[model samples]
Target: MTQDSGVGRICQKPVSALLFDMDNTLFDLVGAQIASCQEIVRFLGYKDGEELFSYFLKPVHGFESHENIRQYMEERSIPIDGMYEKACRIYETEKLRHISPYPGVAETLKYLHDRGYPMCIVTDAHSRDATLRLEKIGLLPFFSGMVAYDMVNVKKPAPEPFLAALEMMRAPAGDALLIGDSIRRDIEPCARLGIRTVYARYGDRFAAGHQDSGADFIIDGMDELPEILDKFNKI
Candidate 1:
């Protein structure tokens, strides 16, 4: 299945299944989170959204933890009786409202679905959050299953989540292609497991400087996926 088709070499086997990273890959989660943080700050009469958003980037409480909101309030000495809960609700609502699929996501997913490629989501988010985000963007129906942090109790860069997804889909690593935004979390771990990798360059927000992602292929947009798959299948 390896072919030097002028778009990097293809995988060693035809991709029978697709594994997707949910957050940044499927949609602009970082953008949504920023919007949500701004809305939260507005509700709290603050002018800086990044001040609150920084809490999520910290190692404490994790990125998706609502405790970030509590910490933000506490650092400012805001009363925590009912304000914290209201802020959490506002954050969740605004985040969901701002989330939408990237350009050509639905069409590409539909195209792959029509071509009989099974797809599953591999995410570090909780199952409930994953479902809510996917459902919000109307992409829930496209996936056959999901492997979330709750199920594996481990995040990416760890092999557990990807391995769980492969087992749930019943697809061998060589025959599966993993599309994700993070080189450390998504591409490298799956590559080690003998799975082919596609780095979604458009969705990458965390990589500060350009570095090799170690992906078998790199696509700038979801529309380019069909062509990549075509190359893989042509072998």
Candidate 2:
């Protein structure tokens, strides 16, 4: 469909099924993650939050896995599983309580849901974690399904997860559009199946004009999506 939208003659292919990335795409992962890390550290009994953050920021510990963290705690003579469990407990009990959906997300999702769009989430995070993240934010009910890395053993930037979500939704890749923030991961892979893409322009780490400009369309925020649909209407 095409419409005389602000940018130009809008051309949107029919989109019966909409797939999204859950991490930085849905929630502000950088903000939520910073909060979660602080809460987890405090739960581990380091009353001074800065100390734990300091330890974690050390180059060797940066972006370590749960198991790597467990070993890190072990190397310091701390109980591995105990602290690990404590960290996870605090994240669930406390960190989750602080998470907020990005502005306009709920209303946008509701609008799409009300319009009979079959929405689904496909993210690179662990399956269970992405599920819980959505549930924590109260947005899980609007989705038809979800696909995560842990489930498929292959993440986006690889076609596996995106293809899996399309298959789960019973939609062909050509008819499905992958809308997300990451250029390399989301836009490139979905393009493999002739799937179009929409870049969530305000998402984390997005350059004003990214290094690789691959998305078929771009919107600064959820509020602009109605226009995107209008663009779709034109085609």
Candidate 3:
């Protein structure tokens, strides 16, 4: 009943590369994001949470759809990008103070970091804030590099961003494992890239098949990762 029994080697030395999702994976983006969404919408004169989530998540599925927003803004003769970017800048600078990692994350990352694991972050979050959270929380140096939606103009569930991360690291796709919270976005895309994925079920706001998910491995905590890797050694 061991996880990763049929996949890559597990010894700490055997697995040298780890790629993580930023938003909900390494940290709890939902909580802070919702808070920021509320603040931004209120600033914009909006009062509905659903509408706010939809507005912020517009760049989630893909950026092409953002063109639609851009167009709508242009039709109204408004500076869409500048306005949102400014609002986003404000949201991010303030939000990082509230952002937090899943329980045991700090120690687990420190464990991996101390072991010399080369880690990279792949995210579909906006430009400044996503990275700032990492830096503000002192987790920034743990990563060797990152690929964000603002950088590539695409979102998760799309392989390009993760692929770019792998390429940037000069690491083969098969040599990496993507650990994240979203099945459709994080797990699915990495799987397609032939990157073995670990579905971080712990601290996930959504359930696995229970909270509406389809991840590969549903973990209960960060400490279990070493055990999972140990089993991989046998496989």
Could you say which candidate leads in lDDT?
1
- Candidate 1, residue 79: Cα displacement in angstroms equals 0.9
Q: Per-residue lDDT tens digits of candidate 2, residues 34-71?
A: 67667766656555444444454465633324443465
Error of 1 at 97 (Å): 0.8
Best-fitting candidate, measured by TM-score?
1
**Per-model TM-score on C-alpha atoms:** 0.93, 0.78, 0.72
What is the lDDT for 186 in model 1? Answer: 93
- Compare candidates 1 and 3 on TM-score and give the better one: 1
Off by over 4 Å in 1: 1-9
- lDDT, model 3, position 128: 74
lDDT by residue (tens digit), candidate 1, 143-230: 9989999999988889999989999999988889999989889988987898888889889977768667778877878888887788
Spell out the clash pairs found in candidate 1. none
Quick one: RMSD of model 1?
2.8
Question: What stretches of model 2 exceed 4 Å from their correct place?
Answer: 1-12, 43-64, 71-81, 206-209
Between 1 and 2, whose lDDT is larger?
1
TM-score of 1: 0.93
Q: Model 3, which residues run further than 4 Å from truth?
A: 1-13, 37-90, 208-216, 233-235
Model 1, position 231: C-alpha lDDT score: 70
